[model samples]
Each structure stands twice: as structure tokens, then as C-alpha cells.
Target: MDALLFMIFAAIAVICGINLVVQTHPISSALSLVGVMGALAALYLLLGGEFIAAAQLVVYAGAIMVLFVFVIMLLNAGTEKKLAIRPWGKYLGAPLLLLFFGMMAYVVQRILPESSPVVFGAFQGGTAAEIGRSLFTVYLLPFEVTSVLILIAILGAIVLARKEVD
Candidate 1:
């Protein structure tokens, strides 16, 4: 079951990643990004990281995607086809991509821990009590900061969507 879920998410991640690179349409690219985020959330769920999975869904798929959609709508981004990359840009692109890959590889190698400790506990109830206890006990500062950041984001989005005063 785990293997199957892993394969499913792996495939989705790869496809969405490729779409992210190759799709020319901005809205389509954003949609593909949502797919990638959703697949990652599913992988988190399979790994027993339920809170992380929910956060991924709520933060990435819910708020971020809606923000992207709103921006696209506000800008009318998909109304016209974007111009193709120029030949000179294409000439410099391949090596840039290779350099980016190399840099990411180096960073991952440098940052990844040799061994990750396994966390054992159940905290999946969607009520305030379960979440509040976990947040206060384990992830107090980050949880509070994340809540504040989300509140700020909501305010910002509302401000952006408001009618302009003449």
C-alpha cells in the first residue's frame, strides 16, 4: 500500500514538475503547481505526517492556489499567448538549468541529516483541543508565527481585492 501510494505521488510530482517547466500558459502552470503541492501533501499523509499533510492542503492548495488564481484573474494573464523564448535566451538556458540542478544537488547534500528520528504519536483530530495541545507543547513559536502570517496574508489579499478609491 505504501509503495503504491509512493508511486502515485512520485508520478504526479514528476508530471507536474515537467508541466511546470514546459507549460507556456501561466494559469496552466499555476494549476500544475497546485497538482504538485497536492501530490506532496498525499506523500506526507502516506508517511504518517498528517498535520504536515493538512498544512500542505490548507496552506498550499487552499490559500496559495486561490491567491494565484486571483492574481491571474486580476491581471488577465491568460488572455493572450505569451511570447516564446528568444534564440539567445534559449542558448543561455541549458547551462543555466544545469547550474541550477548542480546548486540544488549541493544544497540537498549539505543540508540533509544523516539520520532522521522517527516521531510516534497520534494527533489527527480536527478539533481545536488536539491541535492546540500539540501546537503549545511541541511547535509553539512556529505555530503562532504561522497563524500570524496567515492572518496577515488574509488581510493582504482582502486589501488587494478591494475596490480602488478615486
Candidate 2:
């Protein structure tokens, strides 16, 4: 059951990732990214990383994707212009991508233990309290730096908008 569920979500994640890369429109790509993130959250849940799953849903799928959509809209980013690809690129891209994917799958299968099952209650210690404690104690500086970087991004967006108005 666990393996089946993992396979389903993993397939969803892979499809969404491919969609994200292949989509021409920014909005479409962003939506595909959200799907990828949601699938990853489910995978994390199956792995018993509850806090990490919640964080993935709330932070990446929710807030970060919202921010991305906002930026895309604010900048009026339209569908990407179609550019002519080289003949070899057009002919070989899909085959090369599939070959790379096959190689990666083979490597991952070789690296991971076959008998290790992801049971729901098999792992622990990913609670919000523990995460908060670790973030505040050990990762405080990095967290603060991230906040400052976000502030800068927001400010930069505002400045750009103001310039466009002027």
C-alpha cells in the first residue's frame, strides 16, 4: 500500500516537473510547480516527515507560488515567444531526456535499499516545535538573512513598478 501510494505521488511529481519545464506560459509553469510541490508534500507525509510536509505545502506550494504568480502578473509576463530550435535539438531532445531519466532511475535504484519500506509511523522528530527550536537556535542567522532578502525583493518590485508608472 505504501509503495503504491509512493509510486502514484512520485508519478505525479515527475509529470508535473516535466510540465513545468515544457510549458511555454509562465502561469502554466507556475501551476505545474505547485503541483510538483504538492506531490512532494505527499511524499514527505508518506515518509513521516509531517512538519516538512506541512512546510512544503504552506511555504512552497502556497506562499512562494503565490508570490511567483503575483510577480508574473505584475510584470505582465505573457506566453513565451516560440523560438526555432536547431534540427538536432528538435529531433533529439525527447530521446535524450528519456535516456537521462533512465540513467537516473537506474542509479537511484542501485543506491536505495530494496527492503527499506516507508511505513507511516516508522520515523519521527519532525514536529513544528522541534523545527522551530532548531531554526531559532541553530539557523537563526540564516533565517534572518532570508527575511532580509525577501524584503529586498519586495522593495525591488515596488521600485520597478514605480518606475514603470513614471
Candidate 3:
């Protein structure tokens, strides 16, 4: 059951990732990215990384994607121009991509063939309390640095907007 669920979500993620790359319009690519993030969140849930899964949904899929869509809208981004592809590229690109994917799969299978299957209750320590404790304790410096980086980004955006107005 767990393997089946993992496979389903993994497939969804892969398809969405491809769609994100292949879509011509920015909005379509953004939507595809959201689908990929959501599928990844489900896969994280299957792996029992509950906190990480929730963060992925809330931060990446929700807030980040909303911000992306807002920027795309504000910038009035249009669909990408279609470029003429070489006949050789049209024939070879997909086959090369598939070959690369197959090689990666084979490498992963060889490396982790005996790995244990993920079960929901098999792992623990993903609770909010534990995560908070770890974040404040072991990961405090990195957390603080990230907060500062975000603050700087916000300030930079404000400055840029002000300059545009002036």
C-alpha cells in the first residue's frame, strides 16, 4: 500500500515537473510547479516527514506560489515565443532524457535495493514540539540567518519599488 501510494505521488511529481518545463506560458508553468510541490508534499507525508510535508504545502505550494503568481501577474509576463527546433533535436531530446532517467533509476535501485519500506507509524519525532525544539537548539544559527536574509529581501524589494516610482 505504501509503495503504491509512493509510486502514484512520484509519478504525479514527475509529470508535473515535465509539464513545468514544457509549458510555454508562465502561468501554466507556475501551476505545474504547484502540482509538483503538492505531489512532493504527499511523498514527504508517505515518508513520515509530517512537519516537512506540512511546510512544503504551506510554504512552497501556498505562500511561495502565490507570491510567484502575483509577480508574474504584476510583471504582465506573456507566453514564451516558440522557437524553431532542429529536426535532430526533435528526434533526440526525448530519447536522451528518457535514457538519463533510466540510468538514474538503475543507479538508485542498485544503491538502495535493500532499503526498508516506509510505514506511517514506523518513524516518529516529526511533531511540532520536537521540530520547534530542534529548530531553536541545533538549527538556531541557520534559522536566524534565513530570517535576516528574508528581511533583506523584503527591504530590497521595497527599495526597488520606491525607485521605480521615483
The TM-score measured for candidate 2 stands at 0.76
What digit string (tens of lDDT, one per residue) describes model 3 on residues 34-132? 999999998888767899999999999999999999999999999889999999999999999999999999999999989877787677788678899
Model 1 per-residue lDDT tens digits across residues 78-159: 5357678899888998999899999999998889857563232332454456667878989998988999998999899788
- Point out where model 3 deviates above 4 Å: 85-107
Query: Model 1 segments beyond 4 Å from truth?
Result: 1-4, 70-76, 84-88, 106-134, 163-166
Please give the ranking of all candidate structures by TM-score, highest first, separated by commas. 3, 2, 1
Q: List the pairs of residues colliding in candidate 3.
A: none
For residue 42, give model 3's deviation from the true position in Å.
1.0
Q: Rank the candidates by lDDT, best first.
A: 3, 2, 1
Highest-TM-score candidate: 3
For each candidate, what is the lDDT? 0.82, 0.91, 0.92
Q: Residue 161's C-alpha lDDT in candidate 3?
A: 78
lDDT of each residue in 1-166, candidate 2, tens digit only: 8989999999999999989989999999999999999999999988878899998999999998999999899999998889899999999998999999899999988899486666877877777887889999999999999999999999997898688563
**lDDT score, candidate 3:** 0.92
